[model samples]
Target: MADIIIKNVYVLTMDSYELTQGVVVIENGTITEVAESTEQDADQIIDAKGSVVMPGFVNTHTHAAMTLFRGYADDIPLDEWLKNYIWPAEEHLTDEDAYIGTKLACLEMIKSGTTSFADMYIHMNDVAQAVKDSGMRAALSYGLIDLGENRSADVELSKGKQFVLDWKGEAEGRIITMYGPHAPYTCSEGFLSKVKKEANHDRVGIHIHVLETESELNQMKQQYGMCSINLLDRLGFLGPDVLAAHCVWLSDDDIEILRGRGVHVSHNPVSNMKLASGVAPVPRMLDRGVNVSLGTDGCASNNNNLDMFEEMKTAALLHKVESLDPTVLPARQVLEMATTSGARALGIKSGVLREGYNADVIIVDMNKPHLTPVYDIHSHLVYSASGSDVSTTIVDGRILMQDYEVVCMDEQDVLDRARTAASGLVERAKF
Candidate 1:
């Protein structure tokens, strides 16, 4: 018998095509059957009532604990924001603070239909605990920033390696771990090399920022005599196991290197625009066969939420304007970035609602005014649907939210603790 059965839903399998009246059977955290109809019984059943059912979203990159700083600092340049506000405030963050903040982030993500995410942040053990308590799947990493200091590099590397040893493949395989070197500008070549060596030794992936701004590119050129992508390539950091966020300043050569190395790109369209970062040549990267996934960066920079649906819409619209071609970044492609491409980036098997895939799925209420008269399901999903429309979120065959209510954690308690934590963090930061 299946563990759960979801029947009579408008399903976007995200594998090849859509099914108007589909039924899914999940057992042992894996999809057992997906078809137009199923006669089998299950321990639990969810009558979707014509709701739209699809694979749960995979957030390829984010600073999950920064949910505390969502609106604390905004309307500033990325460099200034980090130098003046974000970093200093982060210095005052404690493990408890991270736990509370991450709880809030998980709640928000669950409500918005995110089942899995890749998070780079400080105090990641606490973040992992939050993920466990909230029943969310995540790829966790400790943000390693050397800042050109040998001692800092040593300590950061030790912490990062220890984190991987402690938590990689933990939480019933719901949590994956990676090594996160903050960026080329923040970490030196030697430090990144050390991280790369350790990541290879452990057989895990590396997550790093690459060329997110013109200033960052210029600084990398002046210091390393090459663009950030080539510099990393020379350091042997480009590979299939690397997830590079923000290629907003890449040249054609950079795109070629990424494609050749089989590196994945996590494109944060909303955050990039908010920070005035240049538009990444996503169409060109796609043409080169680069797997470009979608993300909403730290909530501090994104200024309020972790909504992949909004990211999809903004990504589609942004590329159209950037290339001055209406044919760029179609709705279907953006949706793929949010689902299948994101799963591929994280090296997971949960993005498609198909047999044998992980049972991570979501149900979006289509009985709304905005979702009415859906001429095309994909078109409406990309151009009209909002995160608020999600009625259920499931990860690893467990329902975290159902009927718009989070079931894993106490929603009110998380919000209350988040408010308290954010207030205390701001006060401690003296900002």
Candidate 2:
């Protein structure tokens, strides 16, 4: 029997040029059937009320537990923000703090229609537990930074590999583990090469920051005599299984190298702009057939929320203005960056609505004033709609949020705990 039935909705399959009023049947956490009509019986039926049903948003890169640091330090440059504020504050973050903060982030993501995210942060076991308890899908990694210390490097590498072994396919296959070398500047060449070898042996994906700022490029050149992209390529670190975040300072050769290596890029528009980092060459990358996805980064840098709708809008508009071409990144392409491309980057199978796909879906209320007069659904989704319009969010055939109410956890309790935790962290950090 079908576990859940969703009927009376406009289904955006996202696989092809087919948008129609249809029905979707979910059974055992996978889509069993999707058609224009259905007569199946199910445990529960979701009447979508003529709303739009599509795949849930995939956040390619983020620091989920950093929700506690949101709005703590803003209007500062990236270097100062990380060195003077974020790193010191993070030093005081305990495992319990990570749990509480990640719970808050999961609540916000559920309400905003994000089903899956890639997180690199401290206390990853706490983060993984939070994701498991909240019923959200995620790729978790411990941020590995050696700072040129051999002992610290050995400890960090061991922790990363242990995390992969312990949690790679845990939480009923909803959690994926990856190796997170902080960046080219922070991790030595030997450490990076060792990580690559381990990732190859374990067959897990790698998540790392790359070329996010001009200063990083200069440092790489002075230290290693190559750009970040070239350096990674030379170390045999660029591959299809790698998710490189923030390629904002790439040259043409860097673009070509990324395209050639099949490396995925997670463009963080809001964080880049907020930190005064230069814009990424997204249009050129797209033109070269690189798989470019979207991410909101951490809340400390973004300073507000993890809203993929806002990211989509910002991505679409920013590139057009930068390229002096309005037709550069259209609405459909931007939406794909949030959905299918992100799934591809994370190597997940839940970003499209089709038979046998994982039932990770969301319903957006279309009866709003802003969503009225919808000539093009894609355009309205990218240009007009906000995260508040999400009426339902489902992950792996389970409803996490319905009618703007999160079902997996206590909303008020999570918020209250997060508030208390953030205050305590600030006090301890003395910032």
Candidate 3:
């Protein structure tokens, strides 16, 4: 007997082009079968007659707790936004703030069909705890910075290392920890090297922001006479294990270096556009055989929400207009970036709806008027579909949201607490 079976649905396995009507069987937190018909009995069976069953999205990069800062500070340059507003406001965020904020983020993601994400931020224990309670998978890290005289490099690294060791494989293997060395401009070479060494020793990955803006690129050139990519490559920090977010200022040489180093790039088109940061060379990188994934950077200040569907649509449209080629980033490819490429970046087995893979799946309702007359599934999914179209979300064979009703956590409580926390933070920050 299977644990759960979803029948009479258009199954998009995402491993190939074939989208067929089939039944998916889930058991033991893994996909057991995907076929035209199943004779298996299950504990709970969903008759999704007018839905598309596909892999849940993986957000490769985000600051989850930054949900509290949504709309707090906007319309400012990246440096000014961070220094004058975001950084100052962050000092007032407490553990409860982080927990409630992350809980709110998890609630939003679950409703929007994202099963997992990679988050780098402060108050990560509270963040991890929130993830655990939300029943979502995550690659989490404590954001590390070592530039200012008041901050000790050793202490930051020690805290990061302890968090990695303490939470790795926790929450029934839903939580994967990494070393987050904030960014190139903020951390010195020696600190990045140390982080790389420690991450290698612990056999975990490194998540860092790389060249999100021209300002960072210029700063690196002024300080080290090289670009951020070259500097990090010299430090031996670029590799397959490195999930570098926002490679917006890359030249051709920098792209080649990233490709050669096997670094996975998280293209945060929404955040970059919101910040007025330059666009990344996603088309060039994909052509060079580099793995590019999708991400909606923190909601509070940049993206304003963790909607992978919006990110997918924005990515498809943004690359098309920027390159002046309508054929650049098509709907299907952008969908892959949000799914398989994202899972590949985080080294998770939850992107494809296949046998022996993690059962992180979502059911998108196609019965709506907007989604009707779907001649092409990919076109409608990428161009017309929104997060509100997701009717069901499942992670690890467990249902988080079924028919728009969230069961893992209390929706109203999370929203209320999040509002209260945001209010208190504003009062404290006085910005």
Identify the candidate with maximal lDDT. Answer: 3
lDDT of each: 0.93, 0.92, 0.94
Itemize residue pairs with steric clashes in candidate 2: none
| Residue-pair clashes per candidate | 0, 0, 2
TM-score of 3: 0.99
- 1-431 per-residue lDDT for model 3 (tens digits): 89999999999888864556899999999999989999999999999998999999999999999998988777988899999889988999999999999999999999999999999999999999999999999999999999943358889999999999999999999999999999998888889999999999999999999999998998899999999999999888899999999999999999999999999999999999999998999999999999999999999655698999999999999999998999999988999999999999999998998999999999999999999998988889899999999999999989999989999999999999999998999888887
Show model 1 residue runs off by greater than 4 Å.
none
Candidate 1 C-alpha lDDT tens digits along 128-233:
9999888899999999999989999999999999999999888899999999999999999999999999999999999998999999999998998899999999
The runs of at least 3 residues in candidate 3 whose Cα sits more than 4 Å from the true structure, single-residue gaps closed, are: 148-151
Query: How should the candidates be ordered by lDDT, best one leading?
Result: 3, 1, 2
Every model's TM-score: 0.99, 0.99, 0.99
Tell me how candidate 2 scores on lDDT.
0.92
* Model 2: per-residue Cα lDDT over 297-374, one tens digit each: 997788478999999999999999998999989999999999999999999998899999999999999999989988
